[model samples]
Target: MASVKTTTLPGGIINRPGSTIDYKTGTWRVKRPVVNLDKCIGCLICWIYCPEPAIIKRDDGKIDFDYDYCKGCGICSLECPTKAIRIVEE
Candidate 1:
């Protein structure tokens, strides 16, 4: 019989918070997202769907991308209802 290892911490517990900010994950991105500001319509659908802190909402009610942390997952482009965001090869 094999002995099972036990953990003092609870399952699905987060030991570290905000750890993603410590690492820049965009270096390996094969595709990048580009935004067409004219077609954006200020919908913010991309910003809401982005998994990373790569979407920036400007004070003027517009949005921009932070490439340093954006992994180019294309989720933003897919979620944009106005087709304002497009994915291009890096």
Candidate 2:
């Protein structure tokens, strides 16, 4: 995938708000986050720390990642008490 040029991003009040959902920001990442479900305790820490709504709570009470907009920020991995989320090369 080609990099999204900074020039195309929102400028001084010139772009629409909440337009992030229109773009898959994860594509810009060099690394991605992988979740180890077995180690996950369903504590919701990852969900709480995620800047994006990438960590989703399932019907079963467990969580899953939404790679579509994750952006590989690693905040979830850092906040997970059980260290269930790991970062890997894309």
Candidate 3:
């Protein structure tokens, strides 16, 4: 299995979880989750629960975030049940 799960920018959304992480860089090593509009229902749970509030709703009903501030806490993914979020390694 992979040691690291996903790598997000500053502010991003994580709707689901499917991986782990390796934090040996001595930094926060925070990563954001990528959300899929096709599978998202706009539940907004991830947004409300995000510690950094990185989640944002697009004008077209799509959702996005700024990874620059994201910590990759994985709370959003664990909260999401649809598995629409994928954690990418940086």
Name the regions of candidate 3 deviating beyond 4 angstroms.
Answer: 1-27
Query: For residues 25-64, could you state the per-residue lDDT of candidate 1 as single tens digits?
Result: 7776789999888888877888888888699997878789
Q: Give the TM-score of candidate 1.
A: 0.74
Ranking by TM-score: 2, 1, 3
Span of ten consecutive residues with least summed lDDT in model 2: 1-10
Global fold similarity of model 2 (TM-score): 0.75
* Model 3, span 1-90: residue lDDT tens: 235446864576544563223333214545658887798888877888887666777887657865645677778888877877787666
**What is the lDDT for 71 in model 2?**
84
Q: For residues 40-84, write the lDDT of model 2, one tens digit per residue.
A: 889998898898878889887788988878888899889999999
**Which stretches in model 2 have alpha-carbon errors above 4 Å?**
1-19
The worst-scoring run of ten residues by lDDT in candidate 3 lies at 18-27
lDDT of each: 0.81, 0.81, 0.68
Error of 3 at 57 (Å): 1.3
